[model samples]
Target: MTTSPESSGGATQSHKPACPTAEMGRWPASWEQEMQSTVNYLWHTDDLLGQGATASVYKARNKKSGELVAVKVFNTASYLRPREVQVREFEVLRKLNHQNIIKLFAVEEMGGSRQKVLVMEYCASGSLMSVLEGPENAFGLPEDEFLVVLRCVVAGMNHLRENGIVHRDIKPGNIMRLVGEEGQSIYKLTDFGAARELDDDEKFVSVYGTEEYLHPDMYERAVLRKPQQKAFGVAVDLWSIGVTLYHAATGSLPFVPFGGPRRNKEIMYRITTEKPAGAIAGTQRLENGPLEWSYTLPVTCQLSMGLQSQLVPILANILEVEQAKCWGFDQFFAETSDILQRVVVHVFSLPQAVVHHVYIHAHNTIAIFLEAVYKQTNVAPQHQEYLFEGHLCVLEPSLSAQHIAHTTASSPLTLFSMVSETPKGLAFRDPALDIPKFVPKVDLQADYNTAKGVLGAGYQALRLAQALLAGQELMLRGLHWFVFSNMAGVTEIQELKRAAELRSKLRTLAEVLSRCSRNITETKMTLSNLSSELMKNRDQVHEDRSIQQIQCCLDKMYLIYKQFKKSRMRPGLGYNEEQIHKLDKVNFSHLAKRLLQVFQEERVQKYQASLVTHGKRMRVVHETRNHLRLVGCSVAACNTEAQGAQESLSKILDWLSHQLLQDRTKGAQASPPPTAPYPSPALKDLVLHMQELCKEMKVLASDLQDNNRVIEGLSRVPSAPDI
Candidate 1:
């Protein structure tokens, strides 16, 4: 169903990678003749996949399943290769079965020639080398894509290790990317032409690999051809892996001497072999330039510093030429796997102005992370306050990294020093409470006839009230200043006077409200009595009318009773007296009902005219009583607040006076006050409480004013007697 680029001969050309194991070229002359001789159709070649010096791979379709597969057709030159080398590639492919290893379908022969061709899986995305050749990846792959490359390569190599196979050639070209079922990129190892079975300690003398990715010893033997006697082990594959990773990460070889890797072989050898202890991995120099060596990853690397830290050590271990120093496959696999297992968490310390990006396991505890922060920022463990995602992170010893939803450079874990100064809270306190002693006292008794006198009283009262509230805040601020500072200063005397002045004003207000509440209560009682008298008068009239009606009904009923008795005695004498008596009783009952209905109608008509006036009087009385209760409560609260403020100020004044006397007696001189602008934790808490209290007081004061207005309104309402 998929097609490649079409050519003039009706055949298409598959994607050719930058460093493909095979290249594109014309097929052998007898290939066409051999294919046409078969009577039964097998597969038809639609495009040239790749061709090399020995063999050409073609994009072929199976006639039976209509599936596309890669067919490797060995030519005359490839036939000269050892029979065992040819057989090994097929045997290795057939034996491996992993998601990261390319799958092999079957082997088939040409029609009449009996020449064999290998059928393999077709990769649509081409080789990893093709991806590196992309313009966007010129500076190396992006971090997320690079992680994918690392994971895939490690998986494929791990599979090879498990199968006891040394790839010999482990580079980008040999890794192919296929589009998986879920649209994910899956990188698979392909073209294991140089692969052979080797164990951890086993040694092999034959050399095979791409030059740039080959080990130093292998390079010395294969390219330099001046090797004495050094057998290659499985560690050679790790060297090639390091080179491949470096290329995938930086988009260039780690070591480039003089002209280039290929042009100056002697220099490349010198650069790798002449290092003091081991091979210097990121060493490069331009033509006729000084050498540039980097022990760490360059700043231009796309990977984060946290990732680079983990990856560099692994590279250093693998890139060493000394066999004794190079890490074994087990150690190498573990280090690379560790990088994939953990996540990068960045922490920013507010006081220290430092950022620490560390690779932490998801299961590591918060205590462990805090220790790391202490190491980086030099802040003590007890002083650190960690916040994540704008919320305080509780320093529970068992809280793990996985509990955090996410952390990155843009939204890192913010750390605050608990002992650090809080300037904002202190600044707020200064404007309200820090009054100078030289300021003139308010003249409250001054005449208010003048405009200036009237404004000054109000302004002074406002300032005094604000200062009182600020003085209250010192209860919490005392935690800091009280512990270490002198108490008997001029500022303390002013604060004492301010508290006394505010308390006196509150007491006077309380007395005024108490008097107002009493007047309203008396007025309400008078109205209630008048309402009771009016109700009593109306009920007396109703009772008199009911008594008179009842008298008339009794008289009528007595007459009917006599008639019935006479009828029972003289049943034979004249006119049916029993029936007559019954009829008269029914008529009397109807008449009594009509008379009561008339009384009820008269009562309703009598009160209808006065309903609105009486209702207004009663409502006024009800509202006045409710306001009186509220005013009574407000008076009590105001008195309590005044008393508490007076006692607190008195206690503070006495303590400071005592301290002053003691200081004079001991001949101890006062030191200047501390100049720190920062507020203590207690001060910050006091500020918040003071703000909320001020808002509540404002609302209460407004309610008290409304209650006063309602009391005044009650006086204008018509008296119950007048209504």
Candidate 2:
């Protein structure tokens, strides 16, 4: 089954052609004739575009439609089982329908020798590899153009997932770009020749496709006679996308080994099992010399810390060694979408000047409000008394005013007991000084009945309660002010301008609360509904028949007055006031017992629910905090590296300046005449050094800018939430 190079075509026999060339290879006469006939059917012989390993692509006009198309004619003689491969690829292509995937028109068969031609949409820009390897190839593509290409690749992979297909052969060469009307480029995924249609029982048997682009799972799968139980699906496409992105960004493959024939195998093994080597890892110093240089590193280290923090979880999900822990596309997409949206909001909010001002103002207002509330409602009894000392007093009962006044001038013991034993004994003491001592002796009935004590004590309690309520109202107002500040400071100007909208929302909430409060009587009726609902379930606390019986007994006594009035006609049923009061006391006691039971049950349930929710939120906050820590650490590292670079660049500049000055001084000393014909060699060297220093300064400035961008990106990550 193995066809040697000589027998097939000996394509490499000639000085290797930049592209496939028929003149450089030898083919069987019959095979050549079959290819020629197929080409003629698809296109004019003069319009033969190019040739690949086993096919010749040609520009052809469809005879029926008169529309131009690209035809791929496969040489059956070169394929191991050409018919099967072609059918498989055709089946896969026909099922795929996406804007980014190339469209398949029709399949044409040559009558003799079983030659087949695939007709596809014509791509004027040809293949990405061809473009990249061309004479005018540039080092770096524009960011927009790169993103366009990336989007196409992702879109095509998404389509594959939709159709349950895997491309197996994804490479730059297989991708095509077409220029749009406005000079925009549109990329399309083509060549499904090596793709597989996955099924439950079936598994890929062979390790096929280009080595550089192969997934690690493929090699493992090939080593085993039976495929791994866990199949590599869409994640494999994601790996390819990662590699493609790295290539586009850096203009080279991420991992290229530096050794002999075994190097490729080593590199592949490392990719499958180990972390990437020689990644940038920020910056470091040598143990010995002043050696420093900026160079491309593995993406494992080269990726910005902010990006690394994002990628770790993604990689954990995508490249999970454990199948159980791995996230499917749906879960991955949902989590990623949430995180990305949060990150966008955070980044945009960071640089707004109003945000800081609002935050400080809100904090200050909250502190002041809390202090006022604490002072008002948290007053001790002693503090309250001290506040109303001279103005207020509790009413009490006792003797006549003259005796009371005399007793008030002395201490309590001497006042009450002494005055009762000898009423005139304390009369010499000043009345006002001992007033408190004598106040307790007066009968409360007489003292409170008088206008002064009633007005003073009652007024004090009312004023204290009013003040507490006012403090609470001020705290509520402060909340409204803080919310206003938040709305005003939003970085999105249009959103900030929607303060009126927020105020309207607040007004709506107020209206709703007002309506709910007004309908409290109706809402109270629902409390019975709640009780009934609770009673219906056997597991509920109120469900016991004994409890229901007790409730009925209590209900009868609850309406004792009504019952007593109605019982007038029925003499035996009527109860005396003493008996009625006794029933009332029993009813109150039963209600208290029921309330205690309900409160205990509710307390347990509330605690358990609170604990569960608290744990969940704590875990989320912990994860967010860790992510923020990583971001902060990365930013700090970037700043350190930048500082180091700046120092180095500064030292170099200072040295250059000093050397130039020294050279100028030497030149002036060597030249005796004030006006010399020409400057000395030292002076000329200084000029050259100055030019070199300027170039280095420009380079350093660019590096500094990149470092600043990285730092800015890191700073945008949110700080950890307070515990």
Candidate 3:
């Protein structure tokens, strides 16, 4: 039943022409004749636009609607079985509606000529191949443009596969974009002449398209003309995509071999033997170098293992001389999905920082962060206190990264922290006159001044805490080296050294604190007497006499208050009565001098702090004067004295409150067995006057309360409250 194939320009075999040419002004006979005869038909040919081997395309204007279109006129005379080719192309084009696939407008059979014409949406920017081969982009496609084209082409091919069609020919020449220069890379699949439908078995075997872009297995099957050769699915187009990508990036094909009379054989041999090669600028050899010889080193070494593995199935199949292994679209998409998944956050240790980059995941927790910190610095978990905005982090093992970020606001947050290990003792530990680390060699006042900063036993606990933290930072530099080297356990030994040093500082700090406690006790009793005497003076009812005596007492108390502020005693120069009572023993000898010096100050800070404290309290008393006037104390002189006395009282109360915060525990070691010095009579006399004044004020306040009640009774009914 098979008859002789119709003659195709005296050629019986199917052949690929070199890229079909388009001479701008040359109107071929077939197009010129069709335009002449179809003057009233839908589309009229304008000029020769582009010509492929089997079709000469023309930019045409629709006669009825004036719509511009591309009219692709098939050259039936140049192809055997042209009808079958036309039908397959028409069916495929009509079924596709994807944005990345060229749109078919209409199909027309020209009169008096055995020619079929396709009217398609005109693409002003001709083809992808032209853009890459153009002068400005001679190096290769730009990265962004390449990605756009790649994604668009894959989408188009996927669309075709979904409809059970296979585009056997996929190349830059067949991919084109519309007129806009902005989207020159928004390529669409065109010219489905070589395309065919997949049978119900979902497979296709065809010898079609340009040879260089062909999958080697497909080429081999076509060449051998074997009936039993395996049929491949839609992967042939994906192979073409890989080839297109390679050529676009490097401006050259990967599998070129020596050409001869046995050119086909040489190409096949090289395709099988040669590995793909190209360099992505600045790509370094990874710890594991490139893949084995069977696979090509890709142009980009930075691609994820997912994408790199995808390249194996993609290019590796194209490298096959026999059947090429490939993945379906679903598998391809699965590999590319994780391209954006992995993100990292860098953690650094404090002071001697060791930056360690770790993957940020929903499962990342503080415990994991602590482990990383421990590896960098030998600071133990107990010593690490991570804080942000004065609030300590709840370092729960189960708290996750996102959970922390929810509490904190954003990523890459750095927690400012420090190590605090030493415990400040509250009381004397021993009666021995020797501080653990102290020497009795001090003879000069200048030596004592030097002691104030670091050598002083009073600040030794603070110094030890500072030293331990500083040493921890220094020890971190060797922590990693020690772990991997013969010097292992060095960090532990250094930590032990810090612990021993702390014991000495603990004894000294305790001794200083104990002496401080005794000083506070003696100072408190003096203040109590001064308070009592001042109150008595205020209550005397002899206005000028009582006010003058109270002011005099206040001046002495003011001197002590100013001295504490000037010396920067955050907890002041006193301790709480309860805390002092809890101590086993107090060292009274050091209190007369060492304790007094604890509240002494440098000249400049002393002046500035005293002046500022005086000014601030003065303002507070000035505010009180307005209230004083409200209570019928309208006399200006009375206002000034009352305001001054109120300010002095406030200053003393502030000092007592600050002292409550100082550590005065009884574990202190006695630095020296020095005798307690009794208070000066001048200070005791000032205290006695204040105590007597307090008794007088209490009596006056009681009388005033009784007088107010009687006056209120005279003005109001018995049921009313006293004013």
Give the number of the best model, judged by lDDT.
1
Q: Per-residue lDDT tens digits of candidate 1, residues 219-295? A: 89888888569899999999888888888886668888876788888778766665544333645556766556666
C-alpha local distance difference test of each model: 0.56, 0.41, 0.43
Runs in model 3 with CA error above 4 Å? 1-47, 179-185, 199-201, 221-232, 258-265, 273-324, 336-723
lDDT of 3 by residue, 267-371 (tens): 443443344432211111232233223343333222223233334455544433333334556655554333224234433333222223333345668677566
lDDT of 3: 0.43
Candidate 2 vs candidate 3: the TM-score winner is 3
Candidates arranged by TM-score, highest first: 1, 3, 2
Alpha-carbon RMSD, each predicted model: 39.2, 43.0, 34.1
Ranking by lDDT: 1, 3, 2
Superposed Cα deviation of residue 124, candidate 1 (Å): 0.9
Clashing pairs in 1: 23-51
TM-score (all chains, Cα) for each model: 0.53, 0.37, 0.41
Candidate 2 deviant stretches above 4 angstroms: 1-41, 44-54, 63-66, 77-79, 82-84, 134-140, 199-203, 220-234, 259-263, 276-328, 331-723
